[model samples]
Target: MIRRMTDTALSEENASLKARLAETEAALEEAVEAQRRLESIVGELQREKFAARSEKLDPEQFNLPLEDVELAQGVLEAAQERARRALKGDGATGPRAPARNRGHLPKHLPRIERVIAPESTLCPCGCGEMTRIGEDTSERLDIVPAQFRVLVTRRPRYACRRCSGAVVQAYAPEHVVPGGLPTEALIAQVIVSKFGDHLPFYRQAEIYARQGLALDRATLGSWVGRACFHLRPIVAQMRENLKAADRVFMDETRAPVLSPGRKRTKTGYFWSVVADDRGHGGTGPPVVMVHYAPGRGAAHALRFLEGYRGRFVQCDGYSAYDKLTAVERPEGAWQLVHCWTHVRRRFVKRLETDGSPIAEQILHRIADLYAVEKAVRGQPPATRLAARREHAAPIIAALRPWLEAQLSRIPRSSKLAEDIRYTLGLWPGLIRFLEDGQLELDTNPVENQIRRIALTRKNALFAGHEVGAENWAMLASLIATCKMSDVNPVDYIAQTLRSLLDGHPKSRIEALMPWQFRDPSSLAA
Candidate 1:
């Protein structure tokens, strides 16, 4: 009996040991899962933090007309849908819409309807008589026909009575040549076609040849080069005045060129500097300028900012800005405001490819900041500053502690963790906007300018040469600035060309700015 009782006790102990062993293994698994989740949360927080710091305010700072934004949004949605379909393997996504061929006459053109009227007059009590008026007449009053005209100038010479040798013809309005076929207006049209329309001179030559004009591309190029030369002073004035502003945005993109010493594959960089003077209730001038260089370096930007004395310059976190000192700056600029959107993009990139819980939290926080911005949008800068202080300050202040606490918990290998650490390092510069009313939350305006150039480059592929690239910078600068000011680019370019040809001085060029030229009364209404 004693032996059997001892065996039973041993069996019970073995069963208990098995149960405890299983429980311990399950607990260890749970601990590992908890660590994984914790790592994810930290990652998400860092992502949000980085994105929040990189956020830019320039693009959304201005109120775009709803019609324009809506139109762009429609295109975007359609493109997105197309992308979805393409992802499903249907076909190419967002290919350019086929050009509508309107040159052909309608297959069944409508004809004018013929009217019939009774020729007999009404019958009277005693007799019926037939009376005819003039034959029924039908005429089309609004008859618009395709009309063309050519101006023929006949310069008649008059001989002096006393001195027959002295003869004179009407001076050609200081614009036309006695024998030249191209007028100032015609030259302006060609200028618009070449620079404004991006039609290379060689291509334009073919287009003209098709119309029986027989103009050489080289000659056409020379004419355009001369036109730009004539307008150089105006461009200079625009640049000088624009850089003089207290705040500016800068962006750069590749501008391929065919350098004489280099192979055809060599390329250059086109740097775009954009500024909006309408920020202070339309009291400021809108300036968009471009500078071309063979490289992407601080020296090119340094030249552009040569005489600029401004308080704030909003730009992406290009390392070049770090090299500038108060003495080096023409304006003795104090600070470089980095963009949060850039920082956010880095974290967003990681999130899309790797699911990091920490990145998600940071995104949430950024969304919160945007929500606050949405509420205060279009308010006066002072009001916006105030709203940010009241609403956004606390959120930012609360984020610091979380960032610090989470940074300690994340592993070094995680990409999200490194992003968080980098953003935290730049905390002072990123959050500097809370102290100043003039600063923007992001560098989106400059980014918008960059995006435009990017799109153009994507379409055209590359610039023909360095000089051609420079012209691209100049023309794009003016065109984009005009667009920002809500002025039709074609109208501004045409008017400026006319005014310049009419002996308009360079100093008064500000009169051509979009916002200034736009009827102020329309703004009032």
Candidate 2:
């Protein structure tokens, strides 16, 4: 009996030892994993601080262990809080800080004051006639949800008593879309929501459905098409105005158009031309016009700028723009003004990628030139010209030789070498800014306008057809121009369409342009 009892006890002890061993092994595995994760987080943090900032950099460099970092941080904070609680020994909640007040609503907003009075005039103790007292006041902001309403029109005909055959009735006001259910204001809202707000038609249709309105995407698209048809003349005038400027900035961004009979999108381009002399102190108002083209070929650019009388055309080093000076036209060929920002960007990339000291030196020199430009910004052309001559010319003269010397040292295939060669090739155009004060240091202004196109592209993904792309360009041009001029796009589109339907003459269309537009209320005041 004693031998059997000893065997059973030994077996039980062995099983318990095995269970404890398994628990310890599992814990060891977890600790190893935690250590690996912490090391990964540390490495990523180091790379992020010291490595190149470009998104094009190695993907592995940015694959940070974010979740592990968060978990570790939480564990540490909890441990620290527990230690503090143990030290305190009294576990009562601490007093909280008062909440910060948000500022009051704008004074310009219309206020609808509502007064709340006591239930009875007499005091609570039943005293005779409660004395007049000051009242407490508080303001809360409120909004009335957008509601669509149908405008009912009534016209009655009257016949003369003596001559019943002759009848007369008041004529109905013309609609932007004759016999269409949408009002001018509603159409304007659709256009603004689509272009300015980047809300796609299908999404807009869904939103309307939520409001108990069963408007289809196709119907909204049709409205956009018709609106573009009517607004084409104004866009054409804007183009004329833009090209008439002595100097204009130009850029192009890709626009995808859906291919018919195929389940794919074809690449297109939106060629943006911007006129803003405010940078160099010229008196012209800023205006931007975008043209949609099936391709990014030089032919499209040439055709777009065919009647342009501008002497100086500023753009990047795209091969297409080479034809700007190569092609012949009624007006003299354009003088190409290359962007210094492009040149600076090349060196910046080289410095970031290759860690080249030479590229860093070049960037600093370019920065000096920009510093001079910054001081002269918004000054008259003559003043800017003088400032460049005084400060910028010396840097350019010094940079040319240094660039040439570095070209000989670096490998011909290297990015740094390629950048140097490009800058040398466009040396004359890059220096032209020093000669003309009206010219900007870069084509950044037009590029800024192109960003809006990118946002719309991201939301809509692609245009349905070529015509849809054209309509996109037209509406974006008007809306962007309105924003540049600080004119409210909603008000501008609604009022402009109303005036057009009211038979406003084409001769007076220039006045309808965003910069030239005037509010009737302002005139009355």
Candidate 3:
């Protein structure tokens, strides 16, 4: 009887140990998942905060809104699957993802059909063909590889033998590059490839060579320079149009330029001045004017903003921008509207490195502001302002005291303290979004424009000269604007070149804007 009781006690002890082990393992898994998520958030914020130039990732590197959405979607789906399994006594357990809203493939896309048939359609018993039935179909996206094509232009000459008159032939068309081997369309492709797709000229030449065309890089680049030279007026006009807006966004990225004889590169800056009002339901086309400056200093910013008509300019916390607020303005007082995204970035960095609870709380509060912005986006300024007053103002009112309290608790010399101080320092500008609904909560729009410049800069490594950099800026601006307007860069560039060569009137240059672009049956001077 004592041996039987001892065995029972040992069996019960073993069960208790197993139960505790399972609980411990689950807790470990939850901790690991939380850390993983924290690391991902920190990494993204760090990349944005530290990778100052080219602002954020491009596809060649990273950053698209789709990326964040897809990530969240994937995590949510996995959690839901786990929850479903766990309800039936599975090991995994976690939060389920929110309901998904998905879209079908575009109906406008051309459908290619392929019908598969069984080896024998005959019925086994009757040895006769079966009656037709319904079909099941699915679609998968596909692409046709790009290939080079040629256009052989011939102008036939005619003469009247009886009169011995001078032979008559149709005059060859005016080309962007007179008597050049490339057609306007081909030149457009080269410009689009280099500027829009971020493919360099030499890379383009190599691509062409693979297709049995031996075009040299210099030849292709020559076409680009000529096209940009003529397109200069359009880019200049775009800048004026952008400045005409009551508010604009501006950002700058580093540009490495080759020092002609030094055999090294000198650092230059590409300033992106943007005008986009769609977020507040303003009926204006978005424009990006990338200006190349020899340096990123107060002098450059001052000179660039010289003719800007607007008083409000949204940007980061660069000291040069601070000086703008003090500058004399004909339109009234110059205002430096700061970006909340920049403020949040500092705390995100602290969170990742220190795992500070303070940073986490700040991020959550900032997220609340963004959620309110999302609801009022595209609404009228008054509507947005009303919503902000209702939803975001209270959050800000509560956050300020909390920030100061936290600041008082942390060491004054600590990095978190420094970040909190930065927030407090820019308190006015950061909260300015709450005052005006027309303004954005961040300078993401301009940074997004800088992203294109950053990507091409990465691929080309550095511009061969400052002039080359200027040319890059001009073409990139036009192409990016075309994209914003949902116009094909290739078509837009080609049409513009044709019209310009055909002497499209200088007074009508405004009609040549990408958003105003259209194809006509005939183009001749």
Candidate 4:
């Protein structure tokens, strides 16, 4: 009886040990999963902050429009031109090196041929006048520094001798500014120089003065105002076209506006609405419409997007955007897709400030995502979706638990913890791109448009008034659209003004849109 009782106790203990072992194995599996998930999510968090390598904006390297490197190149070219002119003026014509692949001049520039016949057209052997032969041609670029000449218009009144007062002078040629001094071409040059070339009106006035013309800053501004009045319809048309797109990119930057009584410049804002189908392999031409507002309030942004027909909008995770998605609207609610670049930027700052290993890890992983994005760019949506599913899905899946685990490891109250939480909060929107290949991984395209506006704001210093700010917005929109459509802002504006002055039907303004512009030469290289 004693032996059997002892055997029963031993059996019970062995069974208990086996059950405990199984429980431990299960716990170990869970821990392993958590570790992997933590890494994956952390990587995503970092990537969301840093964005892609190509999209990285370094002010030192790429201040854009006004980049230091470009400025240096211009200075060097000017100096080279001066030296060449001096050497030529000295009249020391020497033998030139034999030409080898040297006749590649731009086809657009007008060529002026100058023949340099041999001294007496006589042969070295005293043979009378050498027989005519084929000539060797060479090209040298030359510039006629903007010669300002007045266009004199004479309207002669000729009353018929045999009939009633029939005074006519072939209706004075049309001008962008009726009865105004500056012609459409001149106005176009001012607009291009100011916005496209980033020259302020005062600087332009100085440049004109150098050309022996008296154009004050105020006079220039008036011309711009007159042109702006005529361009209102076109700007409105551009807005309608942009809003009609199925997907649009939205971004904003601050501008300085002169205050009436504050004795200081008041802050204003510029919003850019971009519709670029080329990045996604869509056939429609890309366009951008710039809008100016007095403040950076949600109201301004919402108003910018008011009556927006597009269902998908890509933008930064600004609080103003909170009012966008899941809200009632005329066209129902639209989906708000967050920008991974904005998210990645935060971690980039973190990594720069303190070499956080987790931040580094996340940035590297995000780079992986960008690599996938770059390869699939300009490809069909189905291809992008397949690539993301095959590659990005596994990374994101592994990221979740890893991110959660890292959160536990770090100090609960630290900024790292905070960043991770912020990233996790936006996890749904960030990961939403995994299914939709139509969406971009970031807002780089639209952000790029904002750079031009930034250049204007950075240089122009400030707008004189709210009206002036509006003009900047209007003109900048046209210039930005012209660039996207491959049309030269100066040529397009000049021709469009002529068309308007010649009475282009208001109802047919669509024909004047940048992409619809008729003259191919007006398109820039």
Candidate 5:
């Protein structure tokens, strides 16, 4: 009986020990998970605050909105030639094309025999006759700002015979507003001036005042506001089309707003979404859009991508994207591809701070990768990916040991050391780009687009209110995408505004997209 009781006690002790071991393991796992979340948050903050400042690009690298002074000489020359033709009573046929010459000089430059007076003239060198040795004459290119012309439409009145009622006129074309002062051309000017030129409405008003046109800022704002409202359906279609794309690239920058209750109204965000509609054989339109939100959060993304069941989204390592790691519909739908440039940027900053030779070498290798990218400029994503894998993958693989070695030697407190550590942390995501050709090495394309807004932001500081900022976003979306697709901003804005005013139905708004309407031949000019 004593022996049996001893065995029971031993079994009970073993069970207690087993339960304690399980509890300890669970606690350890929880601690590890918490540490990971904290580290992730810290890394995200580092990426947002510190990463991009390392590689500063020249402002000229981006084509910021053209100031009047920056128009190309040839373009201005063309415009001037047209104006001269118009002033000379030549219509749009353009002075009859100056008839092509059969390999002969024009009469203007024909060689002329010199008139000589034997007794009156002598060469300065005391020769028998003087000769012209390149006269000091100059040819100057000149331009004039576009001058406005008015067209008046007259309708005749007729009286009905043997009737008291009189017929005054025929019905007017449906789209044009009766007695409206603004013409399609004038409306186009306003659109391009505000969006392409980034001149605020008030500034544009001041400009018009200089020209003796007393247009109110409020009226100009009303025109812009109405123009954007007219195009909102198209803009909405663009958003939907962008999300429908299998791949999208996104980024955001600050947009300020003015709220009456708030002490500072200049804190808001504008989100940009860019997608290559051509990627999935989407011949409809290549879409790019900007959405203004009160704050920057995953909800903004979720709203933009609400109906999109795309395969992947490529963005920098922003925590907002972490929320979409899995979803029910579009099974295998959302894969997050991080940006290598972001990772490299962290190390680049560190290298600059620490003056590390190894970091420099790694950067040189990255430069080589960029060189390859430059060489394959017009190649499709798949071909580019293949080329990158063949040339860049080996270098990236070779980098692992170098990175590990540097991390070991560097002190943790050093900024360069933290950069290296952060970079290594993102190794799996960064290197994943090498494996998929569709993915970009960096989010620079989207970031490149954002730089324009950043500059306008720098100049203007912030928008007036949330609605005003939203208008800025809508207009920027259309104007920027038009610029990207090689459509003339002036022509497109004018045409779109005219169409919408002329009773063009909003149901087929996608047809108005710049990419859709872009004639390839027009792009060459």
Candidate 6:
């Protein structure tokens, strides 16, 4: 009997230990899974930090893979919550960090204040009265939804007492669109909303419908077309002013237009030309013009630049610009200056893809050149030319031979070889900045303007027709120029349309340009 009791106790102990072992194994698996998730989060954070922004530069570079990071963070929080519950025996709450305050809102924004007062002015202790003291105030930003209102115009008519046949009355104001119901302010708002804010007409129509205004997309389209028609003369004047500059920056971006009777959209182009003398301190206002074309061809560029009297045109390494080299005009022959940014981008891509030390070295040298340019920016052209010759020329001289030697070592089919050849081929144009202070190192100004078009294209998808694309270009040019001038685009468009309808002379229309615009108050004074 003693042997039987001892064996039974040993078996019960063995079974209890096995249960504990299985529980421990499950805990271990949970901990290991948590550790794996944390490790993945760290790896992704590292990649996100080090990756190139442009996919063309490094196709492998990820653009902020936040979904995985968020998932890992959630898992970590859940595990911590479980651990807290186990330790505290339930009803335990996790502590949260207090939210940090963002900076105060701008004082320039108009504020609407509401006062909250006590139910009784008497003190809580039953004092007879409480004297007013300084009150604490807090501000919260609020917005008022846009509302549409009808503008009624009534011109009273009178007749002479003796001669009833002869009648006289006040002349009615001219409308931008004859018989159109929308006012100039409303038209300006529509244009600004579409091109400046990238809101499509269909979406804008839906928003209006929600506000109890039944505006059709076709009506909005018609309004935009008419506005562009009225604004075309202004754009034409802008182009004339842009072409008259000594140097100009030109670039192009694709704009797809929907073809009638087809489901597919045809690719169009917006050729942008920008003139800014601020870089070299010339005495001319900065302006930009975008010309729409059904195709991206050399002929479009040639036609747009037909009457341009500019000495130098800065552009990328596109062969379409090569056609401009053949033009022999009496005013002046166009000098095509290649962008250093384009050349540097080639090496930048190679560095991102292959980790080439040679590419990095080239980039360093180019950066040094840019540093010199920065120091000379806003100085006279003569000063800029002198600075480049002194600081930038020697670097270029050294870089050319190094690049050629590196090129010979690389395989003919390699990207590095292509980049080296491109730089060498455009070497003359790249160095032209040394000759004239008026020339920019790159066509970045025009490229910057093109980005706004890209945003609009991304939102609208494609223009409804070729004419619609032309209308888009016209309005965008004015809006972009207004932005550049720091003028309120809506106010400028509204006032200018009213002035144009008021029979403002075409000869004096330059006064209405964004750079030259004056407030109605100032104009009246």
Estimated TM-score for each candidate:
0.66, 0.76, 0.76, 0.80, 0.70, 0.77
Taking the tens digit of each residue's C-alpha lDDT, what string does model 2 give over 1-525? 999999999999999999999999999999999987687567656765665434234766555657678789999998988887788765556663343332466665577888877688986787788877686456677899888888888999889999759899998888867888888788888998989889999999999998999999999988877877778878888887887899988899999999999999999999998999888777787899899999999999887777778898899999889888876666777889999988887787667556799988988898898899999999999999999999999999988998899899888987678889999999889999989889888888898789889888999999999988988999999988888877777778878888887888999889888888766432210
Worst 10 residues of 4 by lDDT: 48-57
Q: Which stretches of candidate 3 lie over 4 Å from their true place?
A: 1-142, 518-525
Candidate 6 backbone overlaps, count = 0
Top TM-score prediction, candidate number: 4
lDDT of 3 at 442: 93
lDDT of 6 by residue, 340-425 (tens): 98898778767866678989999999999999999999999899999999999999889899989999898999768898999999
On a 0 to 1 TM-score scale, where does candidate 2 land against the true structure? 0.76
User: How close to the true structure is residue 364 of candidate 6, measured as C-alpha lDDT?
Assistant: 92
lDDT digits (tens) for residues 151-231 of candidate 4: 888887778889996876678876666787888889999998998878999999999899888889999988988899888
Output the TM-score of candidate 6: 0.77
The CA lDDT at 52 in model 5 is 49
Of the two candidates 2 and 5, the one with more favorable TM-score, higher being better, is: 2
lDDT of 2: 0.85
Model 6 scores what on Cα lDDT? 0.85
Clashes of 4: 14
RMSD of each: 13.0, 13.3, 14.1, 13.6, 16.9, 14.5
lDDT (10s digit) by residue, model 3, range 1-525 = 999999999999999999999999999999999997788777767776675443223575545647888899999998987787978667554574543422367565567889987789889999688987886455667898887677789999999888986799998888888876888889999998988888998999999898889999999999888888888888888877887888889899999999989999999999988889989999888898888999999888888777888868899988888888777777886787888889888887778677899999999999999999999999999999999999999999999999999999989998889999988888888888888889999999988888888889989999999999888888888988887777788888887888888888999889988778654422111
Better of 1 and 6 by lDDT: 6
The reply for model 6, stretches above 4 Å from the true place, is 1-108, 123-127, 159-168, 520-525
Q: What is the model-wide C-alpha lDDT for candidate 1? A: 0.69
